[model samples]
Target: MLLLVVSDNCQNTLPVELLSEVEINVDCSNPDSDDLIGYIERTYVVQDAEGNISDPVTQTITLERVTIGAIARPADIIFPFDTISCSSGYATDEFGNPDVSVTGVPTTIQENYDQASAIFDYIDISVPGNLILIGDDESVDVDLGASFPLFDMTFNVISVNTNGFISTASGDAVPDSECPLSLDPNSLANTNGARIYALQDDLSADTTEDALAGVYYEYMTESPILTPSGMLTGVSIFQWKVDHLEASGDYDLDFQALLFDNGEITFQYNEIGTEMGSEATVGIQSFAMDDNTTPLHATTISCNTPNSVNSLSAVGLIPPTMGGIDLYPFPEGVSCNGYSQYNDQIVYTDSCMTKILRTFTIGEWRCNDINERYFNQMIDIMDVEGPTMDQLTDITVSTEPFSCEANVLLPAISPDDDCNKADIVIDIEYEVGSRIENAIGDVIVEMPLGIYTVTYIATDKCGNESRMSFTVTVIDAVAPTAICDADQISVGYDPSFFTAVALDNGSFDDCGPVTLAIARTDDPGYPDLAIFTDELEFGCMDIGNTYEVALLVTDTANNTSICTSNLMIEDGIAPFFADIPEDITIDCTEDIDTYPFDNPTVVDNCDLPDAFTVSLDTIDINLCGESMIERVFTINDSDVSDVQLIQINFVNQLAVTGTIDDSPVEGCDASDAPAQTTVSGLVELDGDLLISDACVELTVTSSDASTGTCP
Candidate 1:
C-alpha cells in the first residue's frame, strides 16, 4: 500500500512520518474495474487517525521497481540497500514534552525484518513452529523487548519435534538450525526437509496506503543447500558500508546474530540457549560470524582488504558472501577487532587519535546494533548535571553581653567536569542586605540594627568558586536607668531628705524587665548606708553631713541595671525631748477655757522661770481621720520645721573644739565667740540655755579652756 507522490513544491525530502496504514471505504457505486489512465475527478477524501477527512493524497498507485541488496534480516529496511538516504529523523511532541525521535528508516523491507526479529525475538522467547501452537511462551521475550526491540520471522524447521526428539514431520516458520546436532551444518550441517517460502514482497505489492509492511515473513533454505553429514560450517562474515549519510561521515555501530541446529527438528522449547552476548561494539568491520559450536556462535572479524571492487578483484575475488552479507565488490574476509569486559574501564580517546574498530561478545542488541553492522565514528555525546548539594539544621547565637542568631543550607560539593579548578572553599557569609547577617557558627543571623552586607562563598571539587551575598540589620536595646530625682538636704521641713531619697519603684528595665537604683550621685561606687530604723525611715539620715551612698537594682537576667541619688548634708540638731516638770503639778483641766496653753507651758530648765512652767489640754478625735483628743502643749520660741541642732557639745554645755562664724560649712571659720551664746535641752545636757561659764569644761574653737567660753 506504498504510494510515493512527490510535489514540485517539495524537493529532495521524502515523507517518512507520512508512512502509515490508513483504512479506506470503497464507493461500491463505481464500476468494480481497474482503470489505468482514467480521469474521474470525483471528490475522494482520506480520513486521519482522528477521523478528520482530508483531500486524498493524490498519487498514482502502481508497482514500484524493486531491488534486492546482498543483505539479510530484520526490524528495518532501507530504501536503496546499498545507498544511504540523506534525511532527518522525525519527532513529535507529547503533553508538551519532547519524546523519542524516529530515526532514519532503511527501506527495501526484505531480510531486514528477519535480522531484527532474529536478534530480539529469540531473546527469551521461543519461536513457535506454526501448527498446534495453541500457547507460546512470550513473557521472557516480551520482557526482553522492554529492554530491546523484537522482530518477526518465518522459520522452516525440518529435524526436531515437540517431544524434543528427532522427527520426520515438518512445521512452518521453523529454523533449520533448531534440529539435532547431527543436523547442524556448523558442527554437523543439516539438510533435511529443505523448505523454500515465496519471496513475500516480490510476488505481492502494496494493497493499502502503508509501505505495505511485512507481517507474515519467511526464512527458507539459501543456495549451496547444507546437509547434516556435510563438512564443518565455513566462516560467515557481515560487512557494512555507510555512504551519503544525511548529516555526517562516520558513526558508532553495533549488531546481534542468532543461530539454531534444526537438522533433526525445530518445533519445541526443550533446548537451552548456546551463547550470550558481549553487547557493545564501536567500529567498522568486514566479517560477522564464526562456526563449529552448538546453538551456533560468531564474532566480527576485521579485514586487511580495502572497500573498493578494484581492490577486491586484485585479491583474486570480489566481495564474498559471509553469514548473509554480500560484500559484493568490496573486500573479502574481515573480523570484529576484539571483545570488551563489563568492568573494563575505558579512557575515551579523541576521534582524531584512534579511528580503529571494535566489537561486543554477543551477536544481537538493539541499542548496540542500531544498524545491521558495526563501526567507530562520532555519533552523539552523553549528558548529565551530576551529583549536587544536600541539607542542614541547628543554629544559635549570643554575646556574653550582646548576641544574635543565624542559619542556612550547606553548599554542594561535586565536580561538573574534572579539572580541579573551582572557586572559593566552604564558607558561609551573613546577610546584612536582605536582613541576614553572616552566620557566626550555627545560627541564622537576623537583620542587625545598622546597615551591612553578608554573602556565602563556596568552591567545587574542581576549585570552581561561587558566592551569594545578602543584607542585615541588628536592632538596638533599651536605654539604661537614669537619675530623674536628685538627692537633697531636709532643711526647715518635714522629711525633706526622706522625700528626696531615690526609690527603686521607678521603671528600671526598659524592655525585658525594669529595675531601679538609688545611689549617692556624689559617691556612686559605694552601697547604701541608710539604716532602716523607726526614726531613720529606711536608713534616712539627720539634717547634718552624711557620707555618699546609693541603692542599685537590676533586671531578672541581670543584664541591664543602673543607680542614681545624691546625699546632701546639712546641720543636724538632735531631736528635742522636753525635760519633765520638776515635781510640778498640773491643775486639772475640766474645760479647755480654764487651762489655756497660751498662759502656761513646760520647759527644759527650772532656773529659767520663763522656760519652767507646765500646762496641758486635750480635745476629742473622730473616726473619719479626725483628732478626737487634741492634746496641746507650749514650747519655747523656735521654727518647728527648721533642722534641730544638737546644742549638747562634748562638755555637756558647749562645743568641744571648732567654732562657727555663721559661715555655710561648720567648724571652718572662727569669730569673736566660737561657742554658741545659747543652748537648751540637748541629748545629755537637758536644761535651758546655760549662761553660767562654770558649767562648760572644754573651750570654744580650740577645746582649750578660756574664761567665759560658754555664753
Candidate 2:
C-alpha cells in the first residue's frame, strides 16, 4: 500500500503489489490566474530481503509548472543621488557594513536607510542628463553616456513597479511635438508596423491625460527583418520581436530627456513596450555599446528646467486607444541604404542604396481600460557618503598524511574561512596519483597507493579567490615474502662406526633468515646444530647407515621453515690375515713330527675374531722308515686362506732283531740244551715283527729238526 498527502493535510491511499513505478497525470483546475503553489507528500511500502514488509516511509515533494516567471523585475538600488562633485572623491564600501558609512561613522538621514537594515542591489550613473532615459524599452540605449565631467555627473537608481513599469516620477512621459499623432488606418499591417501621423486636435491638451498617456505593444510573426539597421530605429525593439508583445497590452512610456538649444529638456517615447506579467519573456537580442569620447566643461552645473512629477494613469481620457489599431499597406522588403524619411516617418534604404518600404498590419498598443490607479515617487537631489574599503582575509588549508589501512583522504588541518563576511565560498581540490578531482569545500578521497596533493580555494562574494595547497601520501599494504630450497648432506667412512656431520647447501629467501638450525630427525639423541655455524653430528653408526636431518630457518618476518636431507655412515670392510706358518723338516732319527702351526691373526673393519685355525696339506713317508708332513692355517671360516700356509715334516730311523726260544722253554728247560736240542727262535725285523714266514736258515746245526718242523 502507498499513501499520499497534500500540503493541506489531505491523505490518499493507493494499493499495489510488487511494482516498479506509478505515474498519474492531473490537469489543475485552479480558480486563481496567479502562479500555482503547493506540495505533495508520499509514503512508500518497502519489503526487506527476509520477505518482511517495513513501515511506510514518507517524503515531501514540491510541484511546479514547466515554465514560470518569464519576465523578471530589475533589482532595486538606493544610493548616490542625482549628482556628485569632483571635489568629493568616491569611497568603496567593499565590506558593506550596515551600521556605519565608509567614513567609519554613523550615516546621515540619506544614509540612514542602510543602518536601519535596508538592502539594495546596485546603483548606476548616466552623463549629460538629457540624452537618454533610465527606464525605457530594452532596445533603447538607456545606459548610453553623453560627454560630461565625472564630477559634474550624479549616480542614481530608478525604482520600478513589481511588473517592471517605469515610475512616472518625472513629467517627461510625453513630448511637445506641436502636433498630435494617431495611428494611420489606411497603412495598417497585420498586428505590426502601425504608422502614426500628426492629427489636428480640436481642443486643449491635458499633459497628464493626453495622447501619450496610453501604451503600445509589438510582436513579430515569422522571420522578420533582423538586419543591424532593423535593430536600430526599426519597427521592432531589439531582435526579440516574436512571442513577446502582441501589439495589444499596457506598456510603460517613461521619460526620455531631449535638450533644446536653450538648455531646456523635452521628452519622447521612441522605445516603449507593454508591461508583461512575471511569466512573460523576450528572446535574447545582442547589441554592441559604442565607445563614446565626448568632452565636458563644468560651469556651476547649471540647468534650465527643474525636475517635476506627472502621473499618466488616467489614460481613460482617450477611449479609442484601449482597442487595437490597424496599419496596413505600408511597405514591403525595404533595402538598407542609410536612414531616410517616408511620409514624415523614419525609413531605411535597400541593399542597392535605394530607399524602400514594406507594408504590414498593426494591432492595439494599449492595455484594456479597467480604471487602474497608480502612484509615483520622485527625488530630484540629495547628498551621500562614500563607500568602505575593507577586504576579506585569505584562508589557509592543510591536511595530515594518508595510509592504506584507512584508505581514504585525511581531514584538513587549520582549515578556516572568514566568517565575518557574507557569501564567502570555500573549495578544496585534490589530486590522487595523476587524477585531479573537482573543487569542493571538503571530500573523502578514494584512491590507490600513490602521492597526492590537495589545494583549498576561498572566494568571497565579491569574486576574490584565494588558494592554498596540502600534500597527502598513501602507503602500500602488501607484505614481503621468502622462498627456500631443500637442505643438502655429505658422507664419510672409517674402519669402525664413525661420527657423521651433516653439510648444508644453503637456502634462499628474499629477506634473510634470522636463525637457521638443523636437527637429526632419524635419531632422537642427536643434537641440533645452528646452520651456517656448526655441522650436524651422527655418532657411531653402522656401515652403510643413513639418517634424516631437518633444517629449520626463520626470517625477520617470523615465518618458520624446514627442509630435510640425508647423512650417510659407512664402516664395513674386509679383514686381513697375519702371522702365517712356515714349512718344517725332521731327520729319520727324530721322534715326533706333529706340531701346531703358529696361531693365525685376522684384522677386520667392524670387529676381529679371537682365534684362527691351521690344517695339514700333505704327509710323506720315506723308504728308510721316516715320514714328513706339510700344514696350513686360516683366519676366516672358509676353506680359502686368509693367512699364509705352513708345512711340517717328521722322520725316524732304527735296526731289526729276532728272538725264538719261547716254546722250548716250556718243554726242555729242564733238560739241558745239549740233550734235547729243541731250541726255538723268533726272527724280527724291527722291534715287533719276527715273521713266521721267515725260513730260519738257522742252521742251528742240527738243532730242532725234530722240535719243530715249523715250516
Candidate 3:
C-alpha cells in the first residue's frame, strides 16, 4: 500500500492518506489574493503486509500563479482589487502595461597571428635615416647588413622602390607598374623575388627636400618592438614619406614596412591624406614571378579601399522594435581617410597571410524571457618563432686501405627553439650525387669517394623552419694491402703453377680492384745454383729448392704495397730402376769376370736418366766348400739414389783314396808285437790330381791267430 501526506509546510505529523496508483497530481494555485503563492511539500511512504515500512520520500509543489475571473496572473505580481458589490464580494483582475529595458555591451575582437604575421610594431624611419631615392617611380638597392627571411628565402639586400614597396631581387631598380596591381605573376608590377607593398601608388618624391619626400630606410640590429616569441631580433624599416602624383588635391601618405628576422612583416600607416588608399595597393606578394604559368599568390589586405584598423567597438544600442530586437551596426568614419592622423596597422598571420578575428558576446539581459542586451568579447593569439642550430663545418676524410668505402663519423646536431623546442623536427636531405649505405648515430659506413652535399632543415611546432648545409669530401689516400701466405708454397717446377696469384693468401685494395705482380727476390749465400728469369722461370736444377718471392698489389689510385713469401719447386718422386736385372747365383769357379752384368736403367720425374750416375761393387763370403758373392748396383740422380744387388757362389771339390795289407803276430800277451802294412793313393780336385803319395799302418784286434795255436 502507498501512503501520502500533503502539507503547505514539510511536517512529519500531517495526516496520511492512501494512494490508489503510482502517479499523483498536485494543485499549485492560490485561492485568495492574501494566500501564500509558494511551494507545498508532500511526504510519501510505502508499507507491505508484513508490517515493513519503506523510507519516507518528500516532494515539493510550486504555486506560481493565481487565477481571477478568466485570466491567470503571475504569482509574483500583485494587484489591488475593489468589491463591486458588497453582498457578492467579487472583483475584476487588473492588467499592468508592457515595459522593457536595454543595456549596451562593449564589442570584443580577438586575433591569432601565426609566426609570419605577428609583427605589429611600427618605427618611423623618415627622419634621421638614409634617403636613398628622391624621384618619381624610382628604385635603389640597399644593404640589409644581416639576412632576413621572406617566402622561404633569405636575403641580405633589398631593392627600395619610391612607389612604396621593396623587392628581394638582386640589383633590382625597376619601379612597379600603375596602381590596382593584378594577381597575375607576369605583370610588370609583380617583379622577381618577394615584394612587400606598404602603399603602392603613383607617387613622386621631391629631390630638394631630402627628409620630407624621399624613400628612407634603416637596418637595426635590435628590434624596437617586443615580439611575443622574443626570437625576432633584427629589423629592417623602409618608410615612404612622399606625395601622391595628383594635380591639385592633397594626397600625402606616410607609411612604413617592417621586416623581421623571423620572416614576419607588418605595415603601419601614420598619416593618410585625403586620397587615402583610393588607388593604392597594400599587400604582400610571394616569390613566383620567375614562371609565367604560376599565379601570383598575394596577401592583399586592400586593393583600392581606404586603409583601416582591425578593431571593434559598440555603437549606440538599438532598442527592441515590435518584431525583433535591432542589432547595432559598426561605427562609421573609422578608417584612415576619415581620420587624418590615422595610426592603422595590418598584420600577416601566416605564410598564407590568414587574418583571424574572433568575436564573443557576454553578459546578456532578458525581458519577458527574451534576450535584450549582451557584451562582446575578442581574443588575440601570437606565436612566430623559428628553430635555431649550431653552425656546421665541412668534413674531409680518406677511404679505408682495404675497402672501397669509408666509415665516417658524423657530427650530432640538435636544434632548439624559444617556443615548442621539444616539438621541433629535423629532416636530413642528400644532394643528387650523394648516398648513404649504413647509418648509426655518430658513425656512417660505406660512403663512396666523392663530394657530398648534406642539408639539415629544422622546423618547430608553428611551422617555422631553419636550414643549413655543408659539404663532405671523401678522398682516396691510403695504399692497398698486400698479403702473402704464411707457410711456404710448394708447386711443380713450372712457371704457370708458381705465380703471384697462387702464392697470395688474400691481397686487396679497399677502394677498387687491385692488380697483382710476382717477382723472385735474390738471397745471398743460398744453397741452390738455379737461375731465374724475369717471368719466374726455373730449370730442373731448381727442383727441391726454395726461393724468396715478392708479391706487389696495386690499386686504381696508383697505391702499391709489397709482401715477401717463400716459393719452393718440389721434386718429391724418387728415381726408380727401369730395367733392373733379377738377382742370380753362380759358382765361384766359373768365370765371374765375364758375367755379362751392367748397371740398371734409371727413371726420374724431373731428372733425365742421363743425369744419373751408377756404381757396382762385389762382396764375398767364404765357406768350407763354396764362396758367396753380392754385386750391388747403385744409381744416383743427385737429389735421390736407388740400389740393386746380385748374388754369386763358388763350390770347392777334393778327394783322397788308399788300400791296406793285413799282418798277424803270435802271442796274445805280447805287448810289443811288430806288424806293418803299407798303401799309396793320389789326392785330386775336379778330376785333376794334385798329390800322389799315401801310406797306412794296422794293429791286431784280438790276436785270433795266436790263440788257436796255443789251445
Candidate 4:
C-alpha cells in the first residue's frame, strides 16, 4: 500500500499524522488575495505486507496569483490613436496621475508576397555596328551611348559575355554552370555586378562561320517599350547568336535581354534549339554592395529550371506594390500637421513586432505651465496553451472474408487551438512492433493482420504539440472454405483403406495453416465400426458399393467449414473355381440319380464362399441306342461368375434269345415233334438292338413214309 500526505510546512521529522488532500480557492476579483497564493509539500511512502516501510518521497508545489486587466483609456485623447500628443501642455491618466511612461515588447510578424506577370515589347538589334565577335569564356564591352536602368542602377556601358549573359558594370562575365541555377544572387562566384541571364550556361561562339556566332547590342535612346512598370522611353537590347559548347551542328541559340529605362528587365527567346537552354539559368540577380563594392546582401528572381518560357515569349519581373495590412489603434479625428509643437511618439512598424508574448504600453504627460507629471499603463498578450485534440480509442477489426488485409476507416480529427485553428497541423503515423511504417491518411488502406500503434499528433503555429496514440488490432476471423473433390473417388478394394485427405480438392484458409478432416456421410450399415475416422476400411461387402463422405477444414482461428463428396469401392477381378474336375463319360446303364464328381472349389478375390452361389446343370442325349450326359457346374458372386462342364455317356448293348415250342408238333411228326421239329425262335433286346431274327424247321416227310408202311 502507498500513502500520500500533504502539509503547508516542511517537516523536520516525519509527520505521524496523515493528510491526504489540500484545497485552495483563488479569488478572481482580487489579485492580491491570500487564498490565491501559497506553497505546499506532498509526501509519498510505500509499505509492504511484512510491515516494512519505505523512505518517504516528497514533491513541492507552488501557487502564484495573477490578474487580467483591460486596456486603459484616458480623456482628452481620441478613441484610437497611432501616436499620443500633449499639445495642451498637460496630459493626465484616467486616475488624474501625471507621471507616465510607455514601452512596447516585440512581436513576430509574418510576411507573405503575391506576384503577377510582367509584359514586354520585342525589338530587333542585329545591325553591323551592334555586332561584336566573342569567343568562349570571353566578354566585350558595349557602349550604350545612354544610361540604361537595371536593378536600381544606371549604366552607360555593359559587358556582354559569350556565355549567354550580360553584366551592368564593367567586368568580365562569369559562366554559371550550376544546375537548377542558384536562387541566391550573392552566391554566384567570381562576379560581383548585377547580371541578367538570358541563358547562362557553358556556351561557345566558335563555329564554322564567324557570322553564325556573335553578340549584338544596340542602345536606342528613343526606343519606347510598354512594360508592367509602364511605357519606357529608353532601352538597351543585347542579343546572342551562339551555340552550346557541348552541342553539334545546327544546334544554335538566339536570345535577347531587354533593359528598360525603369529598372525592369525582360528575357526573350527568338529561337531556342533542342536542349539549348535546358540546363541554363534564365533569371536576374543583384547584390547589394557597400561603398567599396563589397557584397552585402542579395536579391534574386527565379523563372525556374528548364526554361518554362517558350520561344517568341519573354519573362520578366513584375514591380512590387504595397499590400494591405491590419493596423492597431486605427486613426481617429486628429489634425497634427497644423499643430506648431507636437509630442514625440514612437511607432512600431510591422517589421519590428514579432513574438507570441508582447506588451503594449501607453503613456500620457501632464504639464501645468512648467511642472510636468506622467502616467503609464501596460497590457500583455500571451498564449502558452497548445491545441486540444480529441481522445482516440483503440480499434479492433477483422479482415475481409478469405483475405489477409482489411480496409479500416479512421475517425476524423480536427484540433481546437486557442489562437488559430487553421494554423494547426495534424499528422498520423502507425508503427508495427518497433518499426514505423509510414504516415497515413484518414483511412488505413489494406492494413494487414497485426497489432499496430497509431499516433495522431497536432501541432499549432507556436510549435505547441499535443498527441494521442491508440492500438489498432487487425484480426483474422474468417473461416476456411472446404472444397471437396467434385468427382467421386474410386478406391480399389484390394488396398482395403483410403485416407480422408484424398477427398480434399483444395481446402484453404486466408490467415494461415488449416487442418483437414473427413468423415463418412452415407450409412455403410456398420454403425459399430469406426468408419468415421480419417482412414476408412472397405471389405468384401463394401466392394461395388459407394458411400458419401464430408471434408471439414478448420483454420488456426478455430473457424471451420464442411463439404461433401462421394467415395466408391470397386472390385474388377472375377471369381474363379480352383481344381476344376475333368470331363467324364459313363454307360447308359449307370445310375444317374446323383452327381458322380465332387464340387470344385470356388475362389473369389474379395468375396467368401458363403457370400456367393453355385449351380449344377445336367443334359442327356440318346442317338441310335446310345446316350450321352453332360454336367455343367458354375459359381458366381454378384459381380462375376465361373463355370465347369463334365460329360457322362450311356451306351446301349445288343443281346439275342431264341425259344422253340413243341405244342404244334403233335400234328406233324418230325415238324412238330418238338419245337425241334416245331421249332419257334424269338429275338429280345436287353438294352438296344439294331437287328433281330427267328427260325423254325420240321421233318414231316420221314414220318409220313413210316405211317404208310404201318397201314
Top candidate on TM-score is: 4
lDDT of 3 by residue, 252-341 (tens): 666777776666666667666765667677666655423253344455555677643221110010111111112223223221111111
Q: Using Cα atoms with residue i matched to residue i, what is each candidate's TM-score against the true structure?
A: 0.24, 0.22, 0.32, 0.33
Query: On residues 508-619, what C-alpha lDDT tens digit does candidate 4 reach at each position?
Result: 9988988776677765542323344676666667766778777777788777778887777666555666776666655555555654655567665664646445465545
Could you give me the TM-score of model 3 versus the true structure? 0.32
CA lDDT of every candidate: 0.26, 0.29, 0.53, 0.55
**Residue-wise lDDT of candidate 2 within 1-711, one digit each (tens)?**
234432222323334233323323323444233433355555566444446554666565554332110111111123232123212433433322111122221100100000011111111111211222222222121221222111111212211111122211222122212211211222111211111111100111122333232222222232122222122121211111111223332223232222111111112222233331222211100111111111111111111112211222100000011111111121122211111111211143221111112111121111121111111112111223221223323322222232223245434333232221444455666563333333343356565445556555555443445565555554433222222333232223342221222233444344333456556675545443333223454323444566666655554444455666665564334455665545455443333334333555665544534445655553554443434554555555444464333222323222224334432434534344434223233332332232331212222222343363334
Best by lDDT: 4
Worst 10 residues of 4 by lDDT: 333-342
Q: How many residue pairs clash in each candidate?
A: 128, 47, 13, 23
Q: Candidate 2: lDDT over CA atoms?
A: 0.29
- Find the number of clashing residue pairs for candidate 2: 47
List the candidate 1 regions with Cα displacement exceeding 4 Å: 1-338, 341-485, 489-513, 518-547, 553-557, 560-564, 568-711
* Candidate 4 local lDDT, residue 587: 55
